[model samples]
Target: MPDDKTALVISAHSADFVWRGGGAIALHRAMGYAVTVVCLSYGERGESAKLWKQDGMTLEKVKTARRTEAENAAAELGVTDIRFFDVGDYPLDLGPDTRDRMVDVIREVQPRWMMTHSKWDPYNTDHMNTMRFTLDCRMVAQAWGHNPGQKVLGAPQLYLFEPHQTEQMGWTPDVFLDITEVWDRKWAAIQCMQGQEHLWSYYRNVAENRANHLRRNSGGQAGGRAAKYAEGFQTVFPRTVDALE
Candidate 1:
């Protein structure tokens, strides 16, 4: 971790951060890192069976419910800011300007670490595109580090969070965060996304699975890995090796 750093997450949909990396966000916040979330879409097309259970809920009503849920989830994780791009929700489309816009945001934030979806997630097309596009923007932004007129930024550590289909997505973890202390808060964060009925049980199971991973890695250490819960990440470009790599 960098000194007094800010951590940012660019999620493909509003519910992604809560479902996948909520513990990581909570851990960062507990450690005093300023956390921000950039949700590429409002996730209107996402699962909303729970929220839609009410009588005669229109699309506008669903949108309102999801927005509130996302806001509440961020608050639970102690996030400082959450920005929604309101981009189309079905699947993330990184056309052309999306990449540039993400680059600009990265330069502005210049965070010490960034988290987002993995590139091979088949569960959601938008997540894969978000992963691909964000990585693309990350490289382009770093390449222009010294160029005049571009926001200056030393490349930040990038971590890929699990997608909806971790097993199917071929997610391999190389980093684990023991979010034991903030596990309750992580649960609280995920519970905020009440719109996604399909997620509640699934994410809780994911949490337990990752917790087991931590336990195995820690060799039953008191707290280091034996912690009851955690989040795992697969990193790209682990360290800066050259001016241009």
Candidate 2:
């Protein structure tokens, strides 16, 4: 096993991590993993509909509000580090500069595992694009020629979190994490995303449903673990294990 107990989460929007991977973040933190979150954009333009409805709302003000909410949510999840790229949303600027920055962060963190959005999300191309961008950065970070003096990153498992419309996204989860113990922390983090109140209940329902999946997959009624809340993930790479237990 790797000596460093660290994990990274790359989120397209500020509040995306809270809704999608908050439970994992909290649970990992509780297990002594330092979880770092990177928010590529504030989601000010596209996702802050509730804030936009209020009077005197400018782009900067909206971004600030979203940032605050993200920070508060990260605190609730016990995140070790939270970074904001501040790159524009709607169509994220996943240019060479941003790619280099991400690669640098990947090298610096040297995470044991990583998490991001699903591979496909037609409704929100930003979500899909972020996953691609993450893959690109991960590859570059592992290239020895990219940055000679810097330490090359080792292969880390990239887990794709459940999307909003799973049916449309073509995402199939192979891993179900039981977050029952950290449900309260995840719920508190979810509440911090005040700008997107509409999604609060929807994600709660998703967690409950995933918990049922966890129980069924573990063994159904005979000897299944009763999980009250859970999160699902589809891994991009095959996991190497020594034993099949």
Candidate 3:
């Protein structure tokens, strides 16, 4: 645990973090938080259709390409500690070993907050499964009995980032973050995902739309905070506050 602020992102796939939480990651980094991203898989088997279309492509090659793209994106987002679990994809292998590894990371980071996928995603079970797995890891990390003499994790707010087809996923944003200052950084990171080029514009549109929502919620035309770009999140737990403003 460092002396400064810290946060963690548990991404189901290598590029998931970039698409979903890049702006938040960049904005927090600017605010002096050491953001650690953990990619459970490269999404090579399921999400590498474009790479597979290319001739002479192999599993390792796809994984390598995806990893490189993730690294590039993470760098653009100012994330220096991006980790890849290499557990495999299509259906992530979230076994005992993976759980233990994730628990260890949770304990090590002791993040003030965490981010992951939505609770439900029928389109991609991997995404939903990852969210559940992350929750389990968080719980284990907080248990003193899990690892004797190891530092236990503190309670951290878990924010569920926006998912594709938000309505279908049953995801409603309770928090809208104005990431106008870091939109350019997020855009640069989004460009690094060459494998999923089709989604570049889609996510950009998401940011813009979310920004509109932010503006409306802030105060509408009556002295609303102007935000050009933003990100939305659904909190899994209730927030404790001294007073409701």
Best of the candidates, lDDT: 3
Candidate 2 lDDT over 1-245, as tens digits, reads 23489899999999999989999999999999988899999999999999999999899999999999999999999985999999999999999999999999999889999999999999999999999999999999999999799999999999999999899999999999999999999999999999999999999999999999999999999888899999999999998999997
lDDT of 3 by residue, 1-245 (tens): 47349999999999999989999999999999999999999999999899999999999999999999999999999999999999999899999999999999988898999999999999999999999999999999999899889899888999999999999999999999999999999999999999999999999999999999999999999978899999999999889999996
lDDT of each: 0.81, 0.95, 0.96
Per-prediction RMSD in angstroms? Answer: 3.9, 1.3, 0.7
List TM-score per model, in order: 0.88, 0.98, 0.99
lDDT of candidate 1 over 44-94, digit per residue (tens): 765666766789888788878888989999999998689888777776668
Which scores greater on lDDT, model 1 or model 2? 2
Model 3 clash pairs are none
Runs of candidate 3 with Cα error greater than 4 angstroms are 1-4
Better of 1 and 3 by TM-score: 3
Order the candidates by lDDT, highest first. Answer: 3, 2, 1
**Per-residue lDDT value at 222 in model 3:** 95
Residue 186 displacement (Å), model 3:
0.4
TM-score of 1: 0.88
